[model samples]
Structures are given as C-alpha cells and as structure tokens.
Target: MSAGLLILFYLGLSLGPLILAWAQELDPRTPWDELATGLGFLALAIILVEFLLLGRFRLVTGRVGSDVVMRSHQLLARAALVLAVLHPFFYISPRTPAPAWDVTRQSVVDQSWHALWPGIVAWLLLGGLVAMALAKEVSGLRYQHWRLLHGLGAAVIAGFGVLHALRAGRYSADPALAAVWLALLALALGALAYVYLIAPLLRLRRPWRVREVRHEADRTWVLTLTPDFRGRLPYRAGQFAWLNVGKPVVSLDENPFSIASAPSAGPEIEFLIKEQGDSTCRTGQIAPGTRAWLEAPHGHLIIDKHPDAAGIALVAGGVGLAPLMGILRELHATGDQRPTALIYGNRHAGQIAYGPELERLAREHGTELVHVLSEPPPGWTGETGLITPDLLRRHFGPPDRHGWLYVLCGPPPMLTMVEDTLIDMGIPAHRILSEQFVYD
Candidate 1:
C-alpha cells in the first residue's frame, strides 16, 4: 500500500505543471487566470496532504507508517527534481524570435541558463536531504547536528525553489501555480517550526523529579525518578528511556538509560546508571529532587508476552545486569517459577552491580545463578573466563529446545560474540532478544 501510494504521488507531482500549462493553450477564451488559481489549489493540496501524513506528531505502531511516509516523501522529492529540470525546456517557445544561447548581450536571467542554476542547487539539496535520511541510522551521527542539517537543507530547497519559479515570471502566467508555490513554501516552514521548536518545547512541560540516588559499588549510581504525571511510566522491564536534565532551551541533550527497576505498581521510576562517558560522569551530582525529562519506553526484550515458555536464559555483562534485574524481580513478584537461568559476566566479582540483590533473588525464587569472571583471585570458584560457547554448553543443555527464550545485553562486541556463539549452538534467531545501550 505504501509503495503504491508513493508511486501515485510521484505521478501527480511530475505531471501537475505540464497539464496546467497545456490546459491554457487549448482554449482561446479559457481564462488562463482561472487555470492558475486551480494550479495554486492543487499545489496547496499536495503539500498539505504530504504534511498530514508525514508530520512528526503521528505515531504508528513500531514506526511502520513513519517509515512509509519517509520513503514516499523521498520518491516525491526525486520526481519533483526531474520535473524542475524539464519545466524550463518545455515552456521555452521555439518561434518566439528569442536569440540562440549567447554570452555577452544576455540579461542576468538569460545569462544563467534561464535561472536554472537555482533549480539545480535546489534539486541537489533535496537529493541530499533524502540521502541524509537514508544514512541516519547507519551513520551514527549526533541527533542535534543531524536535525539542524535536515532543517537547513529543507529551508534551502523550499526557499530556492520558490525564488526560481517567481523569478522566471512563468508561474505568473498561471495564478494557480504561483499560489501552489506559496503554499509549498509555507508548508516547508511549518514543518521545520514544528520539528525544531514545538516538539522540544512540549517535551519540557512535564519533567521527572529525582526521588532518590543510591550509589552502588564500583561508582555505579541508581537514580529513582518520580514522574510528575500520576501514573507509572508505561515501559517494559527490559526497555529504556531518554532522560533529560537541565532546561529545554539550553541543556537539550538527553541520554538513553535502561530502567533498572521493575514495572512497579507505583509512580516512581528508576535507572541503573554506569559512570562511563561524559554525560554519565556527572550522574554523581544528580541530587534528589533534581528535575529531569523522559522520552521512552522502547525495545523488544521484555519477557511479559512469553508467559508459556518452558524456561528463559538471561545473559548479562557488567551494568547490563540492570534490565535483567527488572525481569527477575518481576518474575519473583509474580511468583513465577519457570526454571529461569541467569548467566552474569563481570571482570571481577567486585564489579557486579546487583550482586547482592541477585543472590537474594536467586535463593528466594529457586532460579539458578551462574557467574563468569574474566579475572579471579586464587581459590576463587564458579565459572571463569568469557561467556564463550564452551561455558554455555557446560552450564545449559543443547540450544535446540522449542520453548526457551534467550535475552542478552552488554557492550556491542561482547554481545556480538555471544550472539554468534548462540546461533552456532543452534538457537533460533527469533528466540533470542538483545539490546544495545549505545546510540548512533
């Protein structure tokens, strides 16, 4: 459906101008001014429809419609470029006694190939905009910089396209085309305003207040936030949320953090934070009652929907144990005894963030806990070295079971290695769920 709609939009965008131009030449008393008015209406409708479908506010489940809208806009933009290039050629009259291309005696408009330079630039920028969208996820670029570039590109394309059309005075030959151009310019500006100004401002209105801050071993801090809203944050146990500190206008940078606490029956939320990089290093100073913002509840690693599974395998490394804590706590709370097995890895036993709590939960819930350490002192027991395939096989049985789920979370390389090992050990791809904290 999305592909077909995009094709229809492309066809309409390509033929709109040509059909309007031809309708005028067909009737001597055709009131070309009326045709121009209609052209304006058509352009207005086209741009308005694009915004209505592709605008930022709409949320389709799992970003399904959003992806479709993006692809549709890209196709239309490309078609617009082709039409823009051909528009001048089609309108130039062969018998108008206009001179052949000349360099010196030409007016400024004719000197620049009928002002095609501006349209050419506009087309290039529009193409760049589409390419940028395609590379957004792959490039791992900063969001603020990407947003600014996207906005600037949109402004340049819309602004230059309008200037190109009006400067030629060809659109003035049809009032509708002129009106269409006006509406298109306004639509483009409106989109930018909504994205840059309104959305960010709204995210500021209701913020989370830090309720408590507890420092665990190894410089890990657990931040509990009480959302201003009265209900619990609608997030799954393994999902993460974007947290904002500082005001909307100035400190607009927010980092995504995994929620450490279970989906509690309360209004408070919690995040298990590791002080690794720049934004997180300052987490020590995040005092109680400090205001923060949240945008959230993403990821597909939760165990909520898989109630009938025979068992679950939870693999965690370092602070990646946070979400696993939520899962275990929820299972304990709900009195679930589904033979859950946890394989936690750390450099040393001292670096485990939720060591004590996990031990207690394991004892109470009858869930087996296996610890893997990279470096252990003399006489140290339990499994050692990385969570390699040999260790997994020695601990758990063969991975070809039908009713088991595997959840893994950690740094990228470690997770990749473990995931590959599991696949090689015969685990089904769909049975394994993974999460990565680092964002592009």
Candidate 2:
C-alpha cells in the first residue's frame, strides 16, 4: 500500500468513532462534556489500533518500515495516554444516571460506581503501561519478560477501556457506536493472540537448526542457521528475523537481527550479531546444532522495490552492516548492473565485519566501498571520524539525485544524522530506507 493510503486508513479508523458519535445527533451537551466524549473516543480508537502496529502485520509494516512502525507505536501510545488521562476531567456534566426526563443523558455522564470502575482501572493501568514503556531501558527487566508484561498489560487496558466506553458512554447506547467499540476490541485482542499463540503454533512445523557460530569482527559473531525442513524462508534482502536460539517455540526470548545472508545464498541464513548483555552474552558461545526458531522476513529495507533508482547508497555503522551485506550479496548473485556504493562506519578497523567479502564485492561486482573509522589506527587511508555531511555530499551529490535509494542501518544517532544529511542534499525522503536498533 502507498504511504498516503496507509495514513488515510489509520486516520479513518482512529477518528471514525468520533465521527460516528457526532452523527448520532443527540442533544448536544456542554462544550467541555462534548470535548471529553470526543477525546475519549479518539483515545480508545488510537489504543485499539496500536495492536495492529506492533502485530507484525506485513500489510502495515511492509509499506512502512518496522522502525517506523515501532516509533509510531511508541509515540501514539504516549498520545493515547495523554488523551485518556484528560478524558474525564473535561466533563462539565453532572455525575448521575440518565433521568426519565432526559433520556439522552446529555446533562449527566455515567456515574454508577460499577460502570465507572472500568474507566478508573483503565486510566491507572494506562499510566503504568506508558511509564513502563518509557522506562524500558532502565527497568532491569529482561527483554522477553518486559515484552510479555507489555503485551499482557496492553491487552488488559484495552479490555477495560472498551468496557468503560460501552457501559458509560452516552453515545455508545447507539448500537452502531457500541458495535464499533466491540469490533475494535476484538481486533485488538485477536492481534495479540495471533502474535503470542497462533504464530508460534505455526512455527512449530518449521524449525531451524544452528549450523555454526563463527567470530566475525571484534565482539561480533556470524551465526548461521539452516531450516530443519525442506522449505526455505521467503525473505527479501536487507530484512531481518527474530531468532530464538535454544528457546521454546512460543518463547519471547527471540531477538530481532538483520539477515546477513542473501536469499540467493542457498537455504542457510546468517546473522551478524554484536555481543550485548543478557541473552546476547551467550551469542558467541552457542553450540552448533542448537534448536532454533525464526519469525522472519520483517522490515522494508529491501532494495528491489527501487529498481528504477539511478544507483544505491548503503550506509552502515558497526553490526548495522549485516542487512546491507545481504543486499549487496543479492545484487552480486543476480548480476545487477546498477552502480552501488557502500559507506560502512565503525569505531575502529577491528569493528568492521565482512572486510574480505566486501573487498571481493568491490573487485568483482564493481561496488564502490568506503570505510569510515572513528578510531582509525596509524596510516589509515580511509575516511576518519563519523560519517559526515561532507562525505555524503561527495557521494550522493545532486548529479546522482534521480532518486538513488539510500538504505541505512545503525545506532539511532548515526541513522538520524545520515538521514538528515541525505535529505539536506535534496534527496526526497521516500528514497531513503532505514531501520535502527530499537533499544526497547
């Protein structure tokens, strides 16, 4: 789907509730009461739609990159929290049941303790959920444990929010509005079920086995995996997968890593992983033949979609080179004649992965390879310091700006700086694809 269409679809879903409620044409309440109702409807809709954003649905993430999807999920969650918190405060109406003289209840908001409890619970839990997400990095919770808690907490909040709307909302008495609320709730919970349960059940039939784990660069390892079955994963170059090495099929222990091996390179897959803390501490030490499961082929960093581009510029930082390697390999395997350049950045020479293979690509495929090191050793001939605008200007000048696709992967700071530089060079935003390391 196109970006415009995807955005319109989202706005339609999130705002549809308020539009429908306004169509009810009941007696208008005080401005503050109506404002409260409208905000509540928007909050509920936004919260419900968040499920699809993180649901790993290709239709959503395919057009928008996974990083975009994740960032949207985080930003929208905060907005929903703000709207939800302020939902009740704007009501100027009395707290009373619908009186016989006022069937529309325009003068009173739902005041029954039983009906109000759900909203109270949801309001408090929503605050906690957002706080947990904001503090995810410093929470001292394992990624998997944090993921489980996040998922369960979101599900509970959605249920309570929908219940409160149905039982207490003035416009919700309209069957149309109530049905939309229930349907949205079903989709929200159903998405959660599919991610945690249905997807795992399906994965059970297609397991993978760890083939090898070889040290690649400083503190980085190249882990190879081959499917235990006959079929290979249908994935595009520059995409990633969730790896669950030595973990259960339904386990949340899986971590996402960009696929380092091209789909053209047989059935085996490889991941260039940096040894971070926690589960990744065992990354370089995993024994071969370990049982593994992969929830794969996510991310929209693929280059094939831009066949019309004049050239390709791949920018990488450290292990971020993994996905770009997949793209370059696929191009080489397919004998793509388009001119391509790779600007790989790292802190030091030892941090660079796939040095020999990249050189081979430069020799055989005519790929322009440039390495940038922050802490270069003596007599270094390549660019020194971080990837600078001057460096990008020399490479992606206006002369080659016929929408040459620039794909980037790295730490958030590097991606941001490089992306801003690219746009400053008059490269249309659509021409760039990026996926950053999501610390959450």
Candidate 3:
C-alpha cells in the first residue's frame, strides 16, 4: 500500500471505535468523563492494532519496509500505554449506583469488583509488557523467550481490556462499539496465532540446508544455503529473510538476515553474517549440512522499483553491505548498463568484505567504487577518514547526479547522516532507499 493509504488505514482502525461511540447519541456526561471514555476507546484500539504491526504481514510491510513497520509498532505501543495509564484518572464522575432517572448510566462511573478487576489487571500487564520490551536487550533473556512473553502478554491484555470495556464503560455498552471491540480482540488473537503457529507450519514445505560456511572479513562469515525443495525463493534483490537454523518449525529461534546473493544467482543463497550476537557469534561452528527453514522475502530496500533512476548509488558500512551486495550482483547478472557507484566505509582495510569481487566489479562493471576507511593501513591508497559530506560531494556533487537512486544500509548514526546529506544535495527523498537491523 502507499504510505498515505497505510496511514489512513491505521487512523481509521485506531479511531474507528471512538467515532462509533460518539455516533451512538447516548446521554452526555461531564467533559472529563467523556474524555476518559475517549481515551479508553483509543487506547484499546491502538493496543489491538499493535498485533498486526508486528505480525510480519507482507501486505503491511511490503511498501513501507520492515524498519518503518517495526518502528511504528514500538511507537504506537508507547502511545497506547500512555492513554491507558491516564484513562481512569480522567474520570471525575461519582463512583455510585446509577439513579432511576439516569437510564443510560452516564451519571456515575462503574466501581463494582467484576467491572474493575479486568481493567486493573490489563492496565498493570500493559505496563509490565512495555517495560520488559524496553529492557529486552539488557534482560539477558533469549530472543525466543522474549518473543513468547511479549506475544502472550499482549494477548492476555487485549482479552481483559475488552472484557473491562464491556462491563464498565457506558459508551462501550452500545452494541455497535461492543462488536467493534470483540472484532478487534479477535483479530489481535488471530494475528498472534498466525505468527506463532500458522506461518511456521507452512514453512516446513520449503526447507533449506547449509551448503557452505567460510570466513569473509574481520569477524564476518559468509554462509551459503541451498534449497532442499524443488525451486528457488522468489525474492527481490535487496530483501531479507527470516532463517531458523537447526530449529523446529514452531520455534521462535528465527532471525532475519539480508540475502547477499541475487535471485538470478540460482537456488543457492549467501549471507555475510558478522559475529556480534548470540546466534551470529557461533557462525563458524555451524555445520555445512545443518537443516534450516526459510521465510518469505521481507524488506523494501530494492532498486528494481525505481527503474526511472539514471544511476544507482550504494552506500554501506560494516556488515550492512549484505543487501547492497545482492543489488550489485543482480545488476551484473542481468547486464544492467545503468551507471552504478559504491561508497563503502569501514574502520580499516581488514574489515572490507568481498575485496576481490568488489574490485572485479569496478574493473568490469564500470562501477565507480570508492572505499572510506577511518583507520587506514600503512600503504592505504583509498580515501581516508569517515564517509563525510565532503567525500560524497566529490562523487555526487554534480547536477547530473541528482537523479541517481541512493541505497543505504548501515548503523543508525551513519544512515541518518548519509540520508540527510543526500537530501540536502537535492536528491529527492523518494529515491533514497535504506534498511537497518534494529529489532529491539
């Protein structure tokens, strides 16, 4: 979907309940009471919508990119938490039985044990859930354990929140708003089931086996996988896949890695994984024939979608060169004649991956290859210092270079600087595509 449409869809889903509640034309309460109900409606809707954001649905992330979707998931979750936290406090209505004349029960807020218990439990769980997520990196918990806890916690909170709304909320008593809550709750649960249960079961049919594992650069290993099935995976050049190496179908051990080889490179796939994390640190120990499960291609840092561009500029740092390599390889295999440039930055000479292959591309593919090193070797001949705007100006400063497509994949700080520099240089925002690995 286009970005505007995706945002419109999200607003509709998040605000639809509130709009429906207002349309009920029920008896009016105090301004504070109505505001409290509005907050509750929005909070629950956003909470339920969180399920779809992290569900890895292609229809949602295909256009906006996984990074955008995941970031949205994190931000919206915090917004919902804030609204939920203040929802009850804003209610100034008296905590008493509804008078005989107040048929709509708008005169007082419900305070019965059954009505309050579910909301209290859900509210507390929501706080814990967000806290655990924010502390995931430092918690020392396995990625799989964190995922399970987060999914189950969200499901429980959604269930209880809906129950509380039905029992305690005056506007929520309307059958229209009640049905909306139930549907959202059902969808939230369904999303969890699809991610944890259905997707894994379906992946069993497309198994893969590790074909080769070899050292490439400093602390980086190149892994090659071959399908045990009939055909190759249909993926765009720069997309990523979730690989569950030596794990069960229902396992949460899967991790996303960008494809380092092009689809045109045949059935075998390659990934340049840097030893930095739990599974990645043990890359060298993985056997050549280990069983693996492959998920569908996920990412939007692709050049094929921008066929109108006059040139392709690939900017990468460290192991972030994985996806950019796939795009370059694809261009070479298809004999694309569009002008291409690669500005790769690393700490030193030893950190540059695929040295011979990149030089070969420069020689044969006529790619304008430039390497930036923060700490150069004794006989360094390439550019020295980080990839600054001054360095970028040397290559992309010309008016003719304004129409080139710039693809970036790197750490957050480097990406931010490069993107800003490119935009400032008059390259349109839509032409710059990027993806970073930052799940937490």
* Best model per TM-score: 3
Q: Which digits, one per residue and each the tens of the lDDT, describe model 1 over residues 318-378?
A: 8888887778777777777787889998888678787788788788877789988899767
For candidate 2, lDDT tens digit of each residue in 72-162? Answer: 9999999999999998999888886778999888788888987799999999999999999989889999877889999999999999999
Question: In candidate 1, which residue ranges exceed 4 Å CA deviation?
Answer: 1-196, 249-251, 399-402
> Candidate 3, after superposition: displacement of residue 122 in Å?
1.0
In candidate 3, how many Å is residue 210 off? 0.8
Pairwise lDDT winner, candidates 2 and 3: 3
Candidate with better TM-score, 2 vs 3 = 3
What's each prediction's TM-score?
0.65, 0.97, 0.98
Worst 10 residues of 3 by lDDT: 54-63
Question: What lDDT score is found at residue 155 in candidate 2?
Answer: 95
Please list the C-alpha lDDT of all candidates, in the order they appear: 0.65, 0.90, 0.92
Ranking by TM-score: 3, 2, 1
- Candidate 1, residue 73: Cα displacement in angstroms equals 14
Candidate 1 vs 2: which has more TM-score: 2
Ranking, lDDT, top scorer first:
3, 2, 1
Model 2 TM-score, 2 decimals: 0.97
